[model samples]
Target: MGLFGSRGRRRDIPNNPALLAAAAENPGGSVAEIDPAYIDDPNGYVPQEAIRGSWLVDSGGKLTGEYEENPRHGVPQDDFSRLTDPDHWLGWLGDDPAAAVRKGIEESLRAQVADAVVEWVKILDAPRFLTGGRRHTEDEQVMLVTRAGLAAAFALSVRSTQHGRSTLLGVFSWVAAHLSEPQGRKDRTWFDLGVGLDWAGERLGERIYELDGTGGTVER
Candidate 1:
């Protein structure tokens, strides 16, 4: 049983009992029963993209506090601030204690960003429009241009040993950027492979990509 009883998923409606009661009249109703008095147009549906964006941004903000502020990690909030500050660059570590701590922090934050990206857009890998394999390939291509990876791409902007410049961040940035845009199915370049790569070039700069190719981004 789910939160809405035996239904496989909850209807996308507000939590108001009156609204739910009115919506229950439809076979799979969500806000269809919403009172006309409260809405400008009775036919309008909520934009799910907005909801997804809110969740992702909110999750990012939470990461700043939830994991970053825990005293046990030995990573000071000020240190974390310096690490995430846009003016600084992120790097990799092999055996240093500080490196390990920063690595853990970076890995956690990257996962949070990646998870948010995945949730933001439910990718449709099926062969829609007869694009076949290209449709599935599209999602893979889009995952490549994470801006965090670009920031860590050995640029001259700002440098640091903090793991903030990991490739995961880059992936997050790309997905977020795509979701951030108001694109429609009619937009020919919306999911174009070249467009995604071009965005990557702009975000990543030319150097880091020359060093780190697109081979490992899709892996765990």
Candidate 2:
């Protein structure tokens, strides 16, 4: 026999009046029970794209078609100019690290500046950072900080040897500077950094995995 009664039989009714009163009070409220078959539908509703138009649509209602082809607008000119200028894309060290390191403390300063610039770029793109739909429009400051930060990160990453104290200090100093910046405190910046770091780490891990596999086995 079970605690209540027999296995097949219904349990004995509760003898305690207080327990019965509590049970009566605890009646299940209105619950719209959904059919299991309704949830089992394979062709369920799926959300569609929220935005339909092209990203390049201008405020003037003009499409960005042939905009790249127009030299008069300076779009093509800017693109070509950037392509011609290798220095624009390449970081601080460029093709030469010896020269950058020889520059000494200035290199560290430049790294801090580079980190600030990266933060600034991310801030510019972020909507939450904007005040009344307007971002910080100080172009000169933006350019200056960006250049400095880029130079610093590049110098530290390339010139600083792994086992050296000075190298570690330089790298940490750059990170500190990045964190000290106003935009760096923002959640968005941290989120972006996390994403970037994860991606870079993943790529490096994949490369290491490949190298380890190659190091282990040789096919006949």
Candidate 3:
């Protein structure tokens, strides 16, 4: 008799014999296809070289030509340097080129988030928080502070995702809970607890380990 319940019954789990054979032959074979553009010149500066493998994908469903882990030519390096350089293209655009470039960057960032913020706010139902408190209904200050905090959290999550550490779901949950209270004043202790739960969920989702006959190992 089977210890779990089944007795003298064939296992229902599907086993791919071909895949098993392939794995046995070539243990390092990857199931996912690596795009050539990303594999070639990940640095972008060295465009002549063959692209290397990358984890970043673009809107077109192609792997980004730029590297994700540690891009050789990236915003913090080349782009920022150019923006700050005296003889750079942006330097020629204005008298106070540095300030102008900074302003332009801010504007661009604001524009990028404008639509996203609107959509997010719509989904959040900001008006619901105004019901109980006179501070929330009469004075716009409470609402403004709440909106700003939520926006800051959203921006932080987006920035974190660029580095492959996305906390959007956590931030969203915290913001939602915060917005549920009257006068838009979130209970920090409660919010922190909620954030912890969200973090646990994230960790659980990323877990790849499974138990086999020998021991526990990473799945795929």
Candidate 4:
């Protein structure tokens, strides 16, 4: 009995007992890893590596909890602040930063589907970071941070007319990979992040959430 009542193989998230427990009553998809470097500090500081917990998606394709069993630090206090030094992004943007970003997106898509074919895919924008602003909102506890504030937080959204499937770890792992690939041809002189997908117009699935490289989604 999967999310949409479609029978599929049972999958598990390795070393994530917390995530496993959370998915106990639901169908499973791909298992993405949680990166410790992307978590925020107790003082509301967004470091080069600041992201916390895993975003839970239920069998019904609804957004659920956004934290782990025990949080490493408290929620961020300020809505605007320097996430990290700009120089930190130099190492991430390699000879082909844009392609790297694409690879990360493909990785996330692969994580969700095991046997199902993607058919076609689309992204709203290239990968870039959210420098400073109330991106996560004052009430939201998930304070997304990247290397030198070089990237923004993203969530994986899958839409289908039929339901009953759960993407195990969401897109946490996909977001982690993008941290090393900024928006640039072959330089790190600038810092920004962007990654989004929508398959609604096709009619097989509709856009439940839009990816604008910013804002909140079911994953990331």
Q: Best to worst by lDDT, what's the order?
A: 4, 3, 1, 2
lDDT for model 3 comes to 0.25
TM-score of each: 0.17, 0.13, 0.17, 0.21
Q: What are the lDDT figures for the candidates, one per model? A: 0.25, 0.23, 0.25, 0.31
RMSD to true structure for each model, in Å = 19.9, 27.8, 22.5, 21.4
- Residue-level lDDT of model 4, residues 140-195, one tens digit each, is 66544332223323322233335322221111112222232355312122111232
lDDT of 2 by residue, 168-194 (tens): 111111111222244642211111221
Clash pairs detected, candidate 3: 39-51, 39-52, 40-50, 40-51, 40-52, 41-51
Give one digit per residue, the lDDT tens place, for model 3 in 49-112: 1222122223443322222222232211112232233232221224763344334333443454
Task: Give the number of the best model, judged by lDDT.
Answer: 4
Give lDDT for model 4: 0.31
Name the lDDT value of residue 192 in candidate 1.
24
Q: Give the per-residue lDDT digits (tens) of candidate 1, residues 1-220.
A: 1112222322232345644344344323222222222223334322122111110012222211111111122211112222233332233222342344334334434444543211111111111110101123547555332322221111011112453221112211111112112251111111122123334334443332232332222211
Q: Candidate 1 versus the native: TM-score? A: 0.17
In each prediction, how many residue pairs overlap at the backbone (N, C-alpha, C within less than 3 A)? 3, 8, 6, 16
Name the lDDT value of residue 168 in candidate 1.
18
Q: Poorest 10 consecutive residues of model 2 by lDDT?
A: 119-128
